[model samples]
Target: MTGAAAGTASRPLLGSAVAALALAALTALVASGSDLVSAFDARFRAGADRAFGASAGSWLGPDGPADAVGSALLGAGLLTALGVLLYRRRPGAALWVLVGLTVQFAAETALETLVGRPMPLPADGSAPDPGYSFPSGHAASATLILMVLLAVLRTGTRVWWSCLALGSALVAAVGVSRVLADAHHAADVAGGVLLGLVVGCAVAWRVGVRSPHLSGKETR
Candidate 1:
């Protein structure tokens, strides 16, 4: 490869490495309870506390209104449905989507275990969850799947930009829902975003590098 080609080829690897480092740093900050992180965590939790009490009368009715959107089952179901739908027409895309989701889930689980962060209780004094919480899994799930969809649906047109905007909105909604439900701290959601962005970018770069349709003639 020419020097320029070599540089282009290495870009994905560099991006993936940077993303992995960012996730590790976030995990360390959360685990060590560094003063700055701790202060931010406290303030973020306080904001959630205020929102929780204020939204009690809303349609979600205080017992986790956002449960349907952020639940693990729903996330899995959505991904599965997409995979099934795309399997026939785009087997590679379907397989890669599954691969991305698996990585996202496993990383979330491992980080939660390692960090051992606790979930905040619901405003109504519900029982504390037994599962570990650090990076919000719902946020991660929403982000990963949405990114996959965007890549698959991308057409190098104005419509592609629209999809990007829509995907971002959905991911943000998932994160906000988790906070309003008192299921995660703001830092936790932020970690999930970072984690998802890295994983999603890595997956997209890998796919782009491999597929002529994505990286060559169809390039945007």
Candidate 2:
């Protein structure tokens, strides 16, 4: 490969490695109950709870809007993107999307199980959310889905920027909602975003490198 090609190839691998390492470090910190992490989590959760309250309704809470974006919205977006790719005869890109999603899901699940961090208690004294909480699954899912859509539909500079802005807003909203609902720590959200980044970069690399036809370049 030429120097430019080599650099392009290494970029995704490097990004994934860095993100993975950061996630591992964060997981260790959470797993070990680091005092710093605990203090930050406590402070942030307290502030969020005060600002939004426990009864902030489903729209601003973790279970309704955020969950919808991560699950139903993501599902719809993924299916649509896959359809576009297949319609354009880019089966390789579609395959990479599936592969990347599978990897992201597995990684998120493994971290959640391995860390086994408990969810924050609701401000209203309700029972805490069930299951491990080292990483916010909603945050990860939203990030991955939005990123995949961005990669698949970036047909022009204007479209790419628009998609990026929208995707970022959605991801941030999901992460913040989790904190507001006391469903996860801020660290958990950060870890989930990093995990998504790791897998998303791999998918982008495969789609851009192996399936140049689907790179979505603008025609003159």
Candidate 3:
């Protein structure tokens, strides 16, 4: 293999390694129960709770808006349909997106199981603190979905650019919403985004290197 080919081949492995390291660091940070992290999380929850007021906050609360968005993304079966379409049209690209999302899901589950970070409580004791809070699964899912969509639909048109911008904004909103709902700490969302991006880029790069025809690039 040429030097360029060798480098291209190695990118996925490198990206996966970096993603694993990020997960490990996040797990340790949550497990250690760092005083600084606790203080920051407390302050964030307090600020959000104060800003949104009780009623409005409850509507946009953890199990309300966040769960609704996540469910719509998964429960409504959009992702599955899209995956099927891509699988029929571009199997390489479909596999890349699937692999990336799978990696994110596995990493998030492991961290949630091992770290068991507790979420901050609301003032009125209304919001439920149900599961581990190390990495925001919603944020990770949103990020992965958006990135995969962008990769598969790379049309290079005005519409394509617009879609990319809108998708990125949507992903950011989901991540921020997790914090606003006090469902996760700022760091948890951040770590999830990092992991998603790493895995997404890794898979995309690998797919591009292996099969350019499937990368949504126009061939004339």
Candidate 4:
């Protein structure tokens, strides 16, 4: 809150803003060329083999929760409640909700339609796809879930380090499972991770700045 401490803290914010701009620019540039886009589309289409590539991938990978009622229960019932309950701090909880919403939007709407990438298919050559594939929702939601959990638990839990370790591990495992299932590409997963980290950290930083107890304690 003081002059020197504030200056030290603002550096990370400045750096992150710069980095986000850079990534946005990079993603934009990659999307501008039709020839390149066509090439990529052709590759994915050609590379996708219904009987083997896509089918094998889907089978090998972890099952997705999009169609599963149980998953919705877990996310809506357990995760949402946990996010609110664990984060007794107002700023932190609000930040987490904003981050969660952002992750969900990027995964379900913006990224999905933007990429229009198809999933690995069955032996009958039927495609299992809703829309684009530039970013994976499963990976994004999984990351957001853990990120929220960590933020919610960070200030309250005595064992903050363990919470972080467990959260990160869970996110990574879920992402790997999604990939193995042929639900998403490695690039899509990476995009999801980056999106989650940026939004989650921004919320965390803003919350930490306002938290009296975490004024100097949070390294985020």
**Model 4: lDDT of residue 14:** 61
Models ranked on TM-score: 2, 1, 3, 4
Please rank every candidate by lDDT, starting with the best.
Answer: 2, 1, 3, 4
**Per-residue alpha-carbon lDDT of candidate 4 for residues 138-203, written as tens digits (9 for 90 to 100):** 555655555545444445555567766766665565555444455655455565666655555555
What candidate 2 gets wrong by more than 4 Å, as runs, is 46-73, 76-80, 83-89, 149-156, 213-220
| Candidate 3 residue runs with Cα over 4 Å from true position | 1-16, 39-58, 70-88, 150-164, 211-220
Worst 10 residues of 4 by lDDT: 65-74
Instruction: For each of the candidates, give the backbone clash count.
Output: 0, 0, 0, 5
Clashing pairs in 3: none
**Which candidate tops lDDT?**
2
Question: Once superposed on the true structure, which residue ranges of model 4 sit more than 4 Å away at CA?
Answer: 4-99, 102-108, 121-126, 148-158, 216-220
Candidate 1 lDDT by residue in tens digits, 1-220: 4565456545656766787788889899999977877688678756655765564545332265565656744466456537643653656766776798799999999899999988866555667667777998777767766655555544467756876776677777777777766678778998898787778767766554554444344533
- Candidate 2 residues 1-220, lDDT tens each? 5566557555766877888899889888899999989888877766765676544555545455644544555566567668867886778778877788788889888988888898876655668878888787777777766655555554466866887887787777777767765677889999889888788877776665553424334422
lDDT winner, 3 or 4: 3
Which residue pairs in candidate 2 have backbone atoms (N, alpha carbon, C) closer than 3 angstroms, thus clashing? none
lDDT score of residue 207 within candidate 2: 66
Looking at candidate 4, what is the lDDT of residue 92?
Answer: 49
Per-model CA lDDT versus the true structure? 0.69, 0.72, 0.65, 0.52
Q: Give per-model TM-scores.
A: 0.78, 0.79, 0.71, 0.62
Ten contiguous residues minimizing lDDT sum, candidate 1: 211-220
- Any runs in candidate 1 off by more than 4 Å, and if so which? 1-10, 45-62, 72-88, 150-156, 213-215
Q: Compared to the true structure, candidate 3 yields what TM-score?
A: 0.71
Residue pairs with backbone atoms closer than 3 Å in model 1 (clashes): none
Q: Which 10 successive residues of model 3 have the least lDDT summed?
A: 211-220
